[model samples]
Target: MITNETKENYNQCQNVNCSTTFVSHETVARYIIKPQLINVLIPNG
Candidate 1:
């Protein structure tokens, strides 16, 4: 692990044949709509 935080994480591959690094993000929704509301807006036949 290179860096770790509440919202984001940074990591690197640990292989002799690989040199890959990446960052991952954590997120939360500010607001959510119910499934029923989604169905009302976008009906499925």
Candidate 2:
């Protein structure tokens, strides 16, 4: 069901910088939601 609570959490708006503007969370989600490797081998022996 489409609820206001979920809308507020996912569709919230905010400024990324000092500029007087607004942006939706979905914008950042595109850059954040992705696959990545966490573990890595160290070069030192």
What TM-score do all the candidates reach, one by one? 0.39, 0.19
Q: Which candidate leads the pack in TM-score?
A: 1
**lDDT tens readout by residue for model 2, 1-45:** 134222322332355664454433322323446668888878997
Candidate 2 lDDT at 26 equals 24
Q: For residues 1-45, write the lDDT of model 1, one tens digit per residue.
A: 333423777889999689699998766545475345344466788
Candidate 1, which ten residues in sequence have the lowest lDDT sum? 31-40
Overall lDDT per candidate, in order of appearance: 0.65, 0.43
Clashes of each: 0, 0
* Candidate 2: C-alpha lDDT: 0.43
